[model samples]
Target chain A: MDTTQLLKGVLDVAVLAVIQEEDGYGYDIVRRLRAAGLKEVGDASVYGTLRRLYTAGALSTYVVPSDGGPHRKYYGINTEGRTMLAEQRASWTRFANTVSLLLTEQHQPTATIRTIGDKS
Target chain B: MSTTTSPTLAIHDFAAAVRAALSDLPSEDVEELTDGLEADLTEQAEDLDAQSFDPGDAVGYADELRAAAGLPVRGKPRLPSAWTANKLRTWASAQRSNLTRKARSTAIGSRTLDFFISLRPFWWVLRGWAVYKVIAALVIGNSIASTLPSSGTEWVLLLLFVTVSVQWGRGRWLPWSWLPPFRTLVSVCSIIALPLLLVLATAWSSSADQYVEDYVPQGLLLDGNQVSNVFAYDSDGQPLTGVQLFDQDGKPLTTVGDPNATPWVTTYAADGTEVILVPSSDVPGRTGWNVFPLNTVDSVDYYSQPSGEPDLSTTTPAVPPFTQVRPLTQQTPSPTAPPTPVPSSAPPVAPEPSATPTPNSGGDK
Candidate 1:
C-alpha cells in the first residue's frame, strides 16, 4: 500500500499524537516529525492537519507572546484526542502484527525451495 | 555584523518565509502556521547567535532547515472555503426569486392597473406644485368659458393658452425655442386683438335690429315695462334666456314676467328693445292673453327701476341687434270698467257714460 495515501487518513491522528507528547508550535511539530522519519510530509500538509484537528475539537490551542517576533500559537491534545490516539495506536499494532504473520507464512515456501535446490 | 541584524526584522523574514511556503493552504491554516513558526524561529535564531555563529554558515543552515521543512521559497495564493461557495449560491437564488416575483406582478394582463399603480411612485416624485398649477389652469379655463357669452369662448381659450405657456416658461419644462415664440403669439392675441374683435362683433350684430314676437311671463317685468323671460330650457334644465339687459356695471336687469303664468306676451320693438307681460284678460275665445308689438313702443307699458343690474362698462352683449328690456314693476289696468252683475229677472242697467273709459277696472259700479 502507498504510505502517502495512508498518511492522509492518519495525519490528524499523527498531529494529535505529537501534541500529546508535549504541546508544540506548528514549525516545532514539523521539525519533530522530520526527526522521527516522516521526512516526506510537507509543511503545508502538517499545518493543514493541525488546523483540521483543531477544528474537529481534538486539539486545543493557546497563544504565547514572543519578545523577538510575532505571537506563537501552541496546540495540545485534549481528552478526546488522547483516547482516539490510544485506539489508533492499538489498531495499528494489531494490523501490523497480522500482516507480519501472513508474510512469514508466505516466506516458508521460498525457504523450502532454497533448501531443496541449493543443498547448502 | 550579527549584532547589527535586528531580531524583529529577522523574525519578520522568517515568518514571511514560512507564510510563502504554506500560502497554498487554506488562509486560516496558513495564518495559524505562520504565527506558530515565527515565534519558534526567532527563539532558535537568538540562541544560535548567542553561541558565536558565523553569518555565512547561518544562511546555509537556515536554507537547509527551510528545505527540510518542505516550505515553498515564495508565498502562494490562498483558496476560498466551502462556506463561501455555498453562500454565493444562496445569494443568487434569492435574487432570482425577487426578479420572478416582480415579473409576475407586472405581466401584460395587469398592465392597465399596473400603469395606474406605477403612477403613485412618480406622483410623489414629481414637483407637486407644477401638477397642481396645470389642473388649476384647466379648471379656470373651463369656468371662464362657461361664464362668458358664446362669442367669448375663443378669447377664454386664448387666455388659457397664454396662462399655460407662461407657467411652462417659469417651470422651464420646454426649450426656449418652442416656448418663447408660442407664448408671444398667444399674448399678442389675448391682450391686443381678441378684445377688439369682440367689440367689432358686438357693434356689427347690434346694427341690424331684428324683432321676434313671443309670449313672455308677467313676473319677468323689470321697472314698469321692460321684462325678460325664457323661451326655452337648456339641457341642464336651466332657463336659456339670451336676452339680458343690464345697467352700466354689467349686472343683469330684473325680469317682470311671472315664470309660472300662462299665455305670456313678449314683444321686441323695431329698435330691438323688448317687453314681456301676462295679461289679465284675453280676447274673445282666447284662453289667455298673448301679444307682441308690431313696431317700437313709444313708451314702456309701465314705469319702474331696472333689476338684476350688471357692470356693463367692460362687458359687450353677444347679439347687439336686440334690446334687452329693463324690468317692469307693475301691470297696466284695462282702459274701461268691467261689466256689472245683473239680477236674474231684471234687464241689466245701462253703464254710466263715465264708466266706459276704463275697461276691466272691476271697481266701477
Candidate 2:
C-alpha cells in the first residue's frame, strides 16, 4: 500500500498543482493532498517536497509570524513551478499511455510439431 | 513518556525529537524544515483516531522530511562505528546533565556564567573550541605542545576532544578503549568543572601577575626559552639591559652566544653578564608573567642551547650545570634591592615540544 516510490517521481508536479490554486502552509497542504486521494503520502515527504521545489526556484515561499507556535511558512506556485507542473504532467501522460497500451495489447501463442521420421 | 500521552506535550516532544534528528543539518535548513511543525503536529494529533501520538515515530517523520527536501536518507543499514559513537555521545550527554545538576543549579556563580553564555550563544556554538582553550590553558598546560604527535594526531585529539566534550557538558563519560582513560577522565572532569575552572584561572592569572614581576628578570622566570623575556639582573637583582650573559660555570649555552635567543636556558642568570632575552610579543592564554609558575622542570628535558638543536638524545651527556639553573644563582641575593614594578604578562605564543606525553594520573593506552 506504500506508494512512496511511485509518489516520489510525481510529487513535484502534484505539489505545484496544489499550491498553484492557492497558498497553503505545511499541514494544510498535507490535508489537501490526502483529500485528492493520494492516501499514502507521508507528512514530512510533502513538507520536504515543498521545500525542495521552493529551493529549486520552482516555487516561492513567505513566512507569517506567530506568538507561541512556530511561524507559518507558506508556499505558492510561481511561473517556473507552473511550467514544471505542465511539463511533468505531459510526460507522465505520454509514459502512462505507452505502458497502458502494452498492458492492454492482446497476443496469441502458436506451436509447431516435431518431425521424428527425419531423425530416424 | 508513553505514546498515550496528551496531544499537546506530544506535539512539543515530537518537535523536539524532529529537531534533534535534524541537528546535524545546517542550522538554516533545520529551521526551515522544522518551521510550523509543532502547529501542524498539534492539528494532526487531534484528528488522529486515537488522541495519542508516539514520540518514537518522530524519526520516521524526520526521514520523510529529509527525503522530500532532497536531503540524503539515513540509509538502509547503519554503519556500526557511527552508530556506536552516536549512541555513546547520546548516553554521555544524558549522564552529563544528570550528574552536573548540582553544579548547574547552584546560586550566584552558575547563574552569572549562564547569563553571559546565553547572551552570546556563539560562545556555546564554539563551546567545543572554548572548552579546548580552557583545558589547554588551565588543566593540560604545556603538556599538549611537547607531547604533540603531529598535525594528524592533533586533529584526532581535537576531534576526540570535541566529541567527548559535547556530551561531557551534558554529563556522559564514555569509557572506550581507543580514547586513553586518563584523557577521558580529564576531559570529562574538565567539561563538568569548566565554568568554575575558568573563574579560578581568570582570578589566579590576575593575582599572580601582581605578585610576580617576572619582567624584573627575577622570580625564576618561566617559559622565557620559548620567547625572549630575558633581562640580565646584577648580583644585586638590578637588570642590566642588553648585557650579554656569563654563566657561573662560564659555559656558552646557545649558538647565538645570546641568551635572548634561548631565554629559557636558566631560571636565574648568574651575577656575570647573562644575556636576558625579553620577548616583544604577548602570550596566548593571558597577558604577562605570573609568580605561580608551573614546575615544568621534569616535563622538559632542558638542553644547553649552544648546539641550537635540543640534545634529547642520550649520546649528549650531563644536562649543563649552571648551564641553565644557574640554580646556584638563586642562593645569592643582590646587595641592593632595586624597586621592581609588576608588568602584565604579554606572552605572544605558548608552544611546548611533546618529547614524552605525560600520563595524567592514568596509564596511556
Candidate 3:
C-alpha cells in the first residue's frame, strides 16, 4: 500500500497532533512532520491540508510579525479539534489491533496426507 | 560583471517576473511570495560571487525554490479550490478573446445614448413655434440686458436666463406627472409671467418716453406754449417749435450748452394757434423729437433765442375751434346702466366677477 494514500487518510489527524504539541508556521510544521518520518509528504499537499483543516474549524491561525522577514502565520489546534483527534486516534488503534490479531491467529491442521498405495 | 546593475535590481526583476506569473493569485499571496523570493535571492547572492552570477540559472533556481515553497507551478498552476480554478480559467479566456472590443462597443453605445438624451428636448423646443416664442422672449430680454453698459445687470440677466431655460427645458422634456409642484410652478411662470412682464416693462419705458416728450423743454423757441401740448400734441407733429430728446430712462437729456441744443422750425396760425416743427436730430445720447404746446410749460425757459430756421412761412394750418366750457345745470345719467331688479326669490346683491375678465370687462367687474 502507498503510504502517501494512507497518510492522506490520516493527514488532518496528524496535523492536529502536531499542532497539539506546539503552534507552528506552515514551513515549520512541514519540517516537523519530516522529522517525524513522513518524508514523502509534499510541501504543497501539507499546505493544502493545513488550509483545509483551518477552514474546517479544526485549526486556528494568528499572525506573528517578524522584523527580519515577512510576518509568519501560525496555526494551532483548539479544544474541539483535540477531542476529534483523540477520538479518531482511539478508533484507528482499536481497528488496527483487531486486524493484527486476526492476521496473527494460529490455525490447527486437520487429518492426513495420502500416500500412493495406502495399506492393504 | 562590468555592468553597473545592482544585485537588488536583479532580485526585484525576479520578483516582478514571479508576480507576472502569479497574476491570478490574491494580492496578499502575491506579496507574500515576492517577499519570500527576495529573501531567498538575497541569501543566494550573499553565498555566491556576484561576478559569477548567471541570471538564467538564478531564475531556474528561483522556480525550484518556489516549487519547494508550495507555490503553484507555472504551466499547471493549482488553485486553492478546483471550482475557483475553473472559474478563473474561464474568465481569463474570455478576457483574452474580446475584452477590448466589448469595451469599445459599450462605450460607443453609452455615449450615443447620452448625446441623444441630452439633445432631444432642445430640438423639440426649436421645432415647436409656441415654445420657441417663449424662449425667444427670454433670449431677447437677456440679450438686451447683456448689451447694456452695466455689468451688474448683465450678470443678473445671464443667471436668470440660465435658470429659466433649464427649468423650461425640464418641463418640456418631462411629463407633468413626473414634475414636482414647485418645478411645475416655475415652468408655468417662465412660460407665461416672464414674457408678460418683459412686454409690460417695455411698454412702461415707452410711456415714460412719451412723458418726457410732452413735459421736458428742448430749446429756446419763439412760438406756442409747451405745457398745453402735454395733453394733446403729437411729438412727431409738424410746425416744429422745439426738439425734445430723451434718454433710455425717458428723462430729458441736457446738452453741454445751448449750442449743442437741438434746433427746430417754428410757425403760428393767425388765431393764436401755434405749430412747432421739430426736425429729427441724431445726436449722441438723444432719442426722437417731440413738440409741445406753449402754455403747458410747467417751468420757465431760461434761454430765449430763436434757433435754426424760423420758417414763418404762413404755412401754419388752421386750428379747429375750441369747445366752450359750460357748467352743467342737470345731473347727467351715469355712464353705466342701473342695476336690474332682482326677482323676489333671487338675492338683491350683484353677481360676483368671474376668475378672469375679458379686456372689454363684460364679465369681470
Candidate 4:
C-alpha cells in the first residue's frame, strides 16, 4: 500500500525529528528524510510542513546567504518542537506495537468471534 | 566546477511561476508559502544531477503546498465569463509583486518601502474620514462647514468609522474570503469619491459664504426696522442742526437705512406748513445722511435739479419734532469736583430729548 496518505499524518513529527538532530534548510531536510527511506515525500509538502512548523512556533528560522544562489533559510527545532516530538513518539510506538501484534497473528480469530464460539 | 548564474536564475523563474499560480491567495499567505522557494528549488535541481532539471507544474506544486499548510484552495469562478476579471486581477497582482521585488533590491528603496508601510495607519484613518464625510454630505445631506469634527455626535461617528476602517485594514473585521473583492470595491470607490468630495466641498463652501453675506444687517436699525434718518434736540427743546453723529467706536454713521431711498421727503413744520427734507452734504460734496437733523430743502429746488449734488444753497435747517421740550437744568458741580470743569452737562441734555421722538412716526424724528 502507498505510504503517502500515512505520511501526511506523521510528516510533522518526522520533520521535527530531522531538524531536532541538526539545523537544516528545506531541501537538506527533504534529502535527509529520503535517505532515511521515505522517498515518496513530495518537495512542496516538506516545504509547506516546514512553514507550518515555523508558524506554529515549533521551529525557528534564520537566513544564511549562499555564495552564488538565493539565501538559504535554515530551520532548527526549538523547545516546543521537542515536547511535541516526545508526545507523538510515544503515541506512534503504542500504535506500532498494536499493529505489529495484529499483523503477526493473522490466523487467529478475532476476540469477538472467539467469545461467541465459547458461548455457543 | 564553477557556479553559474543560469541555474539560480532558472530557480528564481520557477519560484515566480509558482507564486503566480497562487496569486489568487492573500498576499501574505503567498509570501509565507514561497519566501525561500528559489533556494530550495536550486538545491533540488542540484541533487537530481540533471543539468536541466524540470520544476514540473507550478499549479500542482501550489496545490500541494496549500493542502499541507492548511490554506484554503484558490476559488474558481463559476462561469466562463468571470474568468476575464480573474485574469485581469491575476495580471495586476503579478505586476505589483514584480514592482515590489525591484523596489526591495536596494537599501534606500527598502527603507522607503518601510516608511510607506508605516504610514498605512494614517492612510486608513484618512480613508475612513473621507468615507464618512462623503456619506454624510451625499446621503444624509448634512452640511459640511469644516473638515474637522465640530460636534460631539460628529466626533463619535468619526471615531466609529475610523475604528471600523482600521480593523478592516488590519484584516480582522471580516471573513478572509469576503475581504478581497470588498477591499477592491472600497479602493475603487474611494478613488472615484475623491473628486466627487472635492466638488461637494466647493459647492458647500460657496453656499456657506452666500449665507453669511445674506444675513449681515446693513446700516442702522431700531427694533428691527431701518432708522431712515436721525434727529437731535437740545436740553432747551430747540432743534439742533448740522449735528454730525459718531457711534461709541468713533465711526462716522454716514449711511442711511437704504442707499436707494428717494432723495426728497416731506415733513410738517411747527407752523403746519410742509417742508422738504434731503440728506445734508458734509465737507461740501459728500452726503452725510447719518448726520442728525437732515437738511431741509425747497421741494421745487430738489425736483428741478439734474443728477449730481443737490443745490447746497437751497438747503435749510431741519424742522424739529417740537419747538420747545421741557428745558433741562444742570446741577452745579460740587466744590470737591476737579477744577478742569468737565463738560458732563452736554451728554445729559441729549438723552432726554432723544427719548421724546418715537421712531415709528417715520423719519420725522
Candidate 5:
C-alpha cells in the first residue's frame, strides 16, 4: 500500500523525532528522513513541515548565516515536541503489535481443531 | 561549476510565485516559509539530478505551507475589519445593491419603489432617534433629556433598542411596520402646510376685518387713550422715528400723559415756538397725532409782555427768540416745556380777575 497518505498525518511526529535527536536544517532533515527509509518524503514537504512545527510552538528555530550560498535555518525540538514524540512512540508501538498479531494468526479452523484434539 | 544567471533567475521566479501565493499570510509566516529557499535551490542546482527539480505546480506549495503551519489557505484568511465597521459596510453595500437592482428593473413604478426603499433606512434611523428621545424624556424625567442619545437614559434602553434593531434587520415584522409609500410626504406637506395654515389662521382665525373700517375720523388712531411701545412711524415707505411730530402747518404738538409718556410734546421741541394742533383726522390719508414744526417766534409777541413783577427778565430766556439757531435734539425730552409754562406764570397777582392773569396766578401757585 502507498504510504504518502499515511505520511501526511504523521509528518509532525516524524519531523519532531528527526530534529529531536539533533538540530537540523530543512534540507538536512529531508535527507535524514529519506536515509532512515522514508524514501517517498518530498523535500518541500519536509521544509513545510519543519516550518509548521516551529510555528506550532513544538520546535524552536534560529537563522545561521553562511559565508556563501543560502543562510541556513535550523530547527530544534522543544519540550512540547518531546512530549508529543513520546506519545506518538507509544501509540505507534501499540498499533504495530496489534497488526503483527493479526498477520501471524492461523488461516484454517481444521488445524486449530486438530491441535485442540491432540492437546486434549 | 556555476550555473548561468538565467536558471538562477528562474529559481528566483519560482520562489516569487510561492511568496505571491502566500501574500495574505502574516509577514512572519511568509518570511519563515521562503527563508533560504533560493539558497537551497541554488545548492540543489549543482547536482545534476536535482538541478531541474522545478516545482511543477508551485502554487500548490503555498497551500502545503499553509496546511503544515495549521493556518487557513492563503486567500481565505478573514479580512481584518472591526465588527462595527464590518456591519456598517455590509448594510451599506446591501442597500446599494438593492437600489441598483431596483433601478435596473424595466417597470417605471419600480424606480419609485426603489427610491422609497432606499429612503426607508433614513426613516429607520430617524425613528430610532425620535423613539429614543421620547423614551428618554419619560424615563429620564426631564422636560428635555440630555441631548446625547447614549446619555440621560439607562443602558437598558440602549440594549432594548439594539435588540429591536437586530430583530428588525433580520426581517421581523412585529417591530417595524409597513411605512407609507410616501415616506417624505409628511415633511414635504408640512413645508407646504405652514404658509397655508398661516393663511387659514390669518383668514378666519382672527376676524381681521372686524376692527378695520372704511372710515375713521382720525388716521392711525389707537382705540385706547394710551398707546405704548410704538416703534417707528413710516414716511412713504421709509421708517422714521425721533423726528419730532409736526402738524401740517409745522408746529410741534406735545402729548401729555404719564410724566414718562414719550417726550413727543411740542414745547419739548423748542421755547417761543408757536403751535397749532391738528386733530388726527385732518391729514388726508393719515390718522395719528399731527403736530407742526417749531418756529422761533418771539414769545413777547405771542404773550403780552409780563407786568407787575419786574421779574420779567428772570422769566424770559436770555437767548432771545430772534436768534435763528436750530437746536439739535438733546437726548431727553427738551426742558423747553417747563420753561414756557414758567414764563406764562411770571405775571404778579390779579390772582382771580384777568383770565390770563389768573391762569398765570394759578400756574405760579
Candidate 6:
C-alpha cells in the first residue's frame, strides 16, 4: 500500500527514462525525478538504480570534476538502455490505459471485478 | 566556494561512515555502491545544510542503497516481524560508525585511537586472566592469590583461556562478526568483564594486605599446641590456688581458645564421674581467666546462668593433676620487694580434698 513499495518496482525504468532525456549524475537524476513530480522517490534509490543500470551495461558513466567538491559520476543511457526503456514505455502505456478504463467505468464494477478475479 | 568548504568535509565524513557501516560487503561491491557518494552527499548537504545529514541518516541511506540493489541486509537477515529489533540494530550500528567518524575527524584523536587499537592484544590477555580468576574463585573455590597461575592445572587453564581470548580478539574465533546476535553477546560479556575484573583486583589487594601485616597470636600456646587452661604447682608439690601467671615478657597468659567459643567442656574423673569444666569469674563484673586452675561450678549453677559466666558464690576451684606430686628441690626468689597482700575482693577458693581421683586441670586439652 506504500507508494515507496510501488516505486521500488519501477525505479529502474524511471532512472533510465531520466537519463535518456539527458546525462545526469546521482543527485542530478534524483532532482530531475523529484521535479518531474515523483517527489516520493529516494535519493539513494536513484543513485543505486543508476549504479545498477551502469553495471548491467545499460548505462555508461563519466566523471566531471568540480572546483570545490568531489568529482561527479554522470550516467547516460546507452543503446541497450534506450531499447529497454522503449519496451517499458509501451508496456506502461498499455497497463495504465487498462487500469484507467477499469477505474472510469463506475457502473461496470461487476464486469471489472469478474475480469480481475478471472485473471487471478 | 568559501561556503562549501565545511559542508564538503562533513560530506566526506558522512560518506566514510556509510562505507564503514557496510564494511562486511566485498571491497569491490562496496566501492561500486559508494563510488560517488561524497559528490552526491555534498550536493545534498549544500541544498539542505550539513546539519540534516546525521550519522543515522547516512547509515539509513546506505541500507536503502543496498536494498534497492537487491543485496542482503547489512547484518544477518532477521524475520520481518522483528521490526523493533531491526530498529535497535540500526541504532547501534549508527552509534558505532558515528563514534569512529568523530574519532577520525582529527589527526590527534585518530592517532590516539589507533594506538589503543594496537594494544588490544594486551587487553585480550588481561581479559583471559580475569575470566580464569573468576572461574577459580566461583567454581574451584580457590582464593584470589596471584596473577601467575599457582599449579599445573591452573597454568594450563590460564594459557588455554588466554589463547582462546586472543584468537577471539584476532577474529580467528567467532569470525561471524556480521551476525548481530553474536556481536551483542560479545559486547555484553566485555561490559560484564569490566566489573568482574574490578572485583578480582579488590580481592587480590586485600590478600596482599594480609601478607604484609604481622601475625597475631590468638591465645596461649604450649609445644605449638593450643593450651585450653593453665595449672600451676609449688616446689613442695602441693596444688596451688589463685595463682596468677604470665609469660616471660609479662603478658598475661589467657586461655588458648576463643572466649566466645562454646562454653562447656566435659571431663571424666578416674571414678568415671562425668564432670563438665566451667570457666568461673572472680570479681563481680570481670573474669580473672589468667588465674591458674580456673574456678569451676556445679552443673546446676553453670546451666542456670544463661550468660555463660559462672556464678562466683557457687563456684569451686578446679582439681589438680595429682593430690600430691613428688618433691623437687625447693627454692625461693630472694625478696626484691615486700610480699603484696592479696586483694579482699578475690573470690574464695575452697580446696576440698575429695577422694575421687583428679582429672587433667587443662580442660579439653
Top candidate, metric lDDT: 4
lDDT tens readout by residue for model 6, B1-365: 13434666766677888888778778888898899887776677666656555324677888888887655688886465586667667667856765675687689989999998999899888777777877777787777655566789988988997887787777776656464476456546756875766676777878778877756666666666645455565656566877877779996566634544635454444455545554546533334556777665565445567776554456666755455553454253543432222222322233322223224332223
Candidate 6's displacement at residue B280, Å, is 99
Tens digit per residue, CA lDDT, model 1, B37-153: 545555555545634422233333333333333333333332345445445555556555544544445566357656766674343222232322233345654322122334465
In angstroms, give how far residue A95 of model 1 lies from its true place: 2.8
What TM-score does prediction 6 earn?
0.37
Model 2: which docking level applies?
medium
lDDT of 5 by residue, B33-61 (tens): 88987776666555435545555566887
Of 1 and 2, the candidate ahead on TM-score is: 2
**Each model's DockQ?**
0.10, 0.54, 0.04, 0.53, 0.35, 0.43
lDDT of 6 at B257: 48
Q: Model 4, stretches more than 4 Å misplaced?
A: A110-120, B1-10, B76-365
Name the weakest run of 10 consecutive residues (lDDT summed) in model 2 chain A. A105-114
User: Model 6: runs farther than 4 Å from truth?
Assistant: A110-120, B1-6, B49-56, B77-365
Q: Write candidate 3's Cα lDDT for A12-117 as tens digits.
A: 7777788899998776776788789998765444655666566445688888897977767788998657866887799888978997776665353223644566
Ranking by lDDT: 4, 6, 2, 5, 3, 1
Q: Name the regions of candidate 1 deviating beyond 4 angstroms.
A: A1-10, A34-44, A66-70, A109-120, B1-14, B17-29, B43-365
Each prediction's RMSD to truth: 26.5, 23.9, 26.2, 17.1, 22.6, 20.8
The most accurate candidate by DockQ is 2
Q: Looking at candidate 1, what is the lDDT of residue B104? A: 47
Which one is best on TM-score? 4
Tell me how far the alpha carbon of residue B105 in candidate 1 is from the true structure, in angstroms, after superposition.
Answer: 58
Q: Write down the TM-score of model 5's second chain.
A: 0.22
Worst 10 residues of 5 chain B by lDDT: B316-325
Off by over 4 Å in 3: A98-120, B1-365
lDDT of 1 at B286: 25
